[model samples]
Target: MSVVSTDAIDKWLLNRKWAPRDLSAPPAGSDLAPVPGDPGMPLLGHSLEMLRLGVRYGLKRYETHGPVSWVRAFGITIVAAAGPEAAQVVLANKDKAYSQQGWTYFIGPFFNRGLMLLDFDEHLYHRRLMQQAFTTDRLRGYLDRIGDVARRGLAGWRPGERFTVYPALKRLTLDIATDVFMAADLPAADSERITRAFIDTVRAGTALIRLPVGRWGAGLRGRKVLEDYFRRSLPAKRASDSDDLFAALCHARTDEGEMFSDDDVVNHMIFLMMAAHDTSTITTSAVAYYLGKHPEWQEKVRAESLALGESPPDMAALDRLGTLDLVIKESLRLVAPVPSLVRKTVRDTDLLGHYVPANTLVSVTPWVNHLVPEYWPDPRRFDPERFAEGRREDKVHRMAWMPFGGGVHKCIGMHFGMYEVKYLVHELVRRFEWSVPSDYTVRWDPTALPIPTDDLPVTLRAR
Candidate 1:
């Protein structure tokens, strides 16, 4: 009888495609001593690990070292910080010391200095203008617009057919963002064009080697395509104030009466579209995967949808859908859309009792904290009840649930994101009964958020 070799088994589990062998060691000059595990290749750092393995590497490092560890990725030194205290210190206490510009620098040439990429006063100024678009009254208006688009998108899906939900949901969200934010009726063809451009752009963010005329070049070309397309639409969008967020941007101003120039509006619109569509797509897919795998939770949400009925439920009704809310929150915890928050140290600072040198890249990984046992029980299980009343797995630590991130820089469209996912799930459960295949397994692609490696296979039946 032939026996399986332990090395072969180890190699099989650590498949280089998903898990790189090069990331199995830490770099010198970096104080990753607090944490154990590989930080990845020389000159490459943990960049590939961050892209391929998602949050597993950080969690392992945190589990071994402590709340803080140092590592290098993509030729940059990163300090991985975990735990509630660490989270509070980084996100709340001293944001000025940590800038979001470090991670977004690559995308800056493509996305421009959008809100999330800006720091200090510039971030504040832009955030103030963006806030107007998400006001209570504005969100109510967006609810009507978002609901119509969501329902229409769901209605178009044929029941019982095995389709890739991520791409479809991405198309759906992109269309919704364009219509609700730009007041632009992007035909399916144009929507696909724009979505493809974004996919390429985000893919470029994770590419290690920028070959001559490679993904990076393609991304730059894609950005030009996006910028040109939006620039043409700017005049029409700016011609009159429409209810769409693009319209809001056209006329948005600070207290000093400053407003975005036509160029500013175009760039900002592209950035907003990318952020909303990508995050919404990932989070929606995660919730769908969990619901498909667990029919009990699916039924719980279906009943809530039934109560919601044909009309778009008001904010109160939407908020009262507590069971569904818990499931969405739990899904985010399990596979956060943005697994890691990257910041560059503006000044030398001490983090978790270590001297972090200036220019060091500080990374706070939500994927790690989400799995830490101290904050969550059975960190690997799909227990939405943990988020429900009494259990409150998230309540264990403020930083425990950072799927949407935290602080003033917290996702401005968070409530909107939650509402969109909740409504999308409500509509899906109301229209169809679905479940994951018996032998289905999900692999995470850490490149562009945590997406199902296999398109999230599911069997759907008409209700």
Candidate 2:
């Protein structure tokens, strides 16, 4: 081979589409060290590179600038902190330097006043009220209904040569969200429209432009559609004693005699429903893709599911899915559904000794932690055994394997999401044999939540 230079490789990876710029110097006599980074391009920054490379782009930044650095992307300067150490400082937030205000610049319009958008005492208050809906008893009830919906939805799959799995999983999850959460009698067309609306609203958050003609406009309209639907249904939910999530929210209360208002109920329901279906779909799809690629592991999990019998696993039965659980955990580490979290510095702060100014956009990337070799050996491989009882690589660091994130903002629905995935995957392994070609691979589109660009097709056959 001809000569290949290190500089050439760095140039290609840092393509940035243009030259990198240095961030502003630290304030006079701040004592903290100045952070090193490349700002990436001019106006657009590294937005396009990020959209193209997904979490993989973080590697380029980390390799070039270490754990703490400043870079420009998506029309703003962001302080990027990678690996477990950086993740710890941000998630722990011992000094209260970061605020949820950072997300307002992105998703506030579509998910206004949702739990993740609130902060400090307000966030705690809302989280406390919402906790009533996810009690242990309610979870058992939700699991029962989820099994029913999972059976009905999965039964409709045709088992084709080129089965587009992601869309199918997406549809199944939305059905679960609507049926278990809403418990309303809706026409097929109405539910379909609602699903399209949720898609628009979520996609519009990062749209380059907000003109009514594109994803932005459609998202605005979608938000109205959802708000109207939930508002109209609010009266019935408040009046009835239904056990669904919607009614639960309407009646949720604390021991101190607190409850949600009409607007509070509506806002929460919209956000919870979007989170329930979309993220679950992503996690479940990842589990399937991994199982398909590694047939030995597929058969391993399949045998266990088959041993459990097919009568819809109860909570105890779900707990017995040890192999499946390990596989799910590994898939989560390899492909974090949310990947990175955003925050804004409320005051000046130092991330691992690098000075960051007030109001600066900050990103703590858990995806980076998942792949760092020190935390996980063979991190890129499909190795669920890393999470086995004795091998527990994830235990090396508290934040090393946070697929649902951590700290106070950790996902509220994570427990339910796990149960939902177990039920769905249990049913799937029992009913069919699936696989991808040995040479096949899928690319996740980073435009939103890292969905498969090709919709992730695989070969499906009836068991």
Candidate 3:
């Protein structure tokens, strides 16, 4: 069972006192239009409902209030926008009205100065330098490291009648991240500690209380631990000519000869490590669950894997798993590893004709958009063929299937992430056959990132 810390309780009490008063009020007689929807409750507002209902909460609000709606969550009134129009407006940020500071309320403290946290010109500069680390040659080298680490990690999993796949996959992805990003073999104890730190940092984003105690406190502590770890490891990385991401970042320079400062490297590493492992784990677990439920799809993907014969196929062979690619896209649609992207309005903006004030938090619910019937036919069904050439449902909108997000601030490691997940799934299918009960349903714990409440139990057999 998950433990709630005392600091969390204290933080909750403090949050109630700190709750905003105009949560249910409209954006005050604007010439444009007011966004619809109630704040839901006093102090707590729609926060608990959102945490409990997850994607359903957003969908219901969208249906009731149209594309643009307002709800009080996390102690403030946030404009929740659904469907492709909202996604395009917010993600594209063509008006320069949205700022990445929306994440500041949640992850800014833990992941300060990371690329995603920057806006405008600063973001472009950092992104350009970081691009050097993800060039084709660099990605190929990372793929080699991912293959080796995934094989080693999978070798430790013992198949049983009932096995919880999520935790195992989480550890495997973290191991892969360590190998590819840091190029260091962490001892078992260190790996466990680092994994815990990453968990805390991520979970802290959704903490009910803003106080620096309990789960929130752990998140703060985790940030320091990561800072220390990266700082201590920096000198060695700076001196080495290693091909790993850490070394690349250390030596990364722009055509203008600009390079990241020591502080920048540590901050970016903490953020990148969390981003690299956490999203991959979520995507892999979702793929495993769907494959277990659909045996035909499983067999089809497995046959592709078996034909390769290589335990960890090379980049060219990995590309040839066409069926697996479809399954990955469908799985991402089904569970969307990073469900929603957050932004804040830097200046007053008009969204779908609704006047949104400056400093308002905005939530772009891509997960909700992924489920809208208008864009996706029979939205809940697990049909990878929707991604196939003939249907191409995702083509309905440029932002329709945004599991990796969209626009300039989209995930930098997206290609690397996809490669890592594909390799792990390929290896797993080749070595094991798994299933969940036909009637089984996964209840995701809606933290900052969604994870299965029961850790995604399944029956496994070694082939």
Best-fitting candidate, scored by TM-score: 2
Q: What tens digits encode model 1's per-residue C-alpha lDDT throughout 142-251?
A: 88888889888888887655867777788789878888888778876887788878877777765567653777887887888899898888888778868989888888
- Model 2: number of clashes? 0
For candidate 3, the lDDT comes to: 0.88
> What are the TM-scores, per candidate, against the unseen true structure?
0.90, 0.95, 0.94
Positional deviation of 95 in candidate 1, in angstroms? 7.1
The digit string of per-residue lDDT tens for model 3 on 1-463 reads 9898845753453333222233233355656766776666778877776776788777777776788888777888889879999999999999999999999998988999999999999999999999899998998999999888888888888998779999999989888888899998999999989999999999998888989898889999999989999999999999999999999999999878889999999989999999999999999999999999999999999999999985568888899999999999999998988888999999988888887888999999878989998899899999999999999999989988999888999999999988998999999998899999999999877767889999999999989
In Å, residue 385's CA in model 3 sits off its true spot by 0.3
Model 2 TM-score is 0.95
lDDT of 2: 0.86
Worst lDDT window (10 residues) for model 1? 17-26
Look at candidate 1 and tell me the lDDT of residue 231. 85
How many pairs of residues in model 3 come into backbone collision?
A: 0
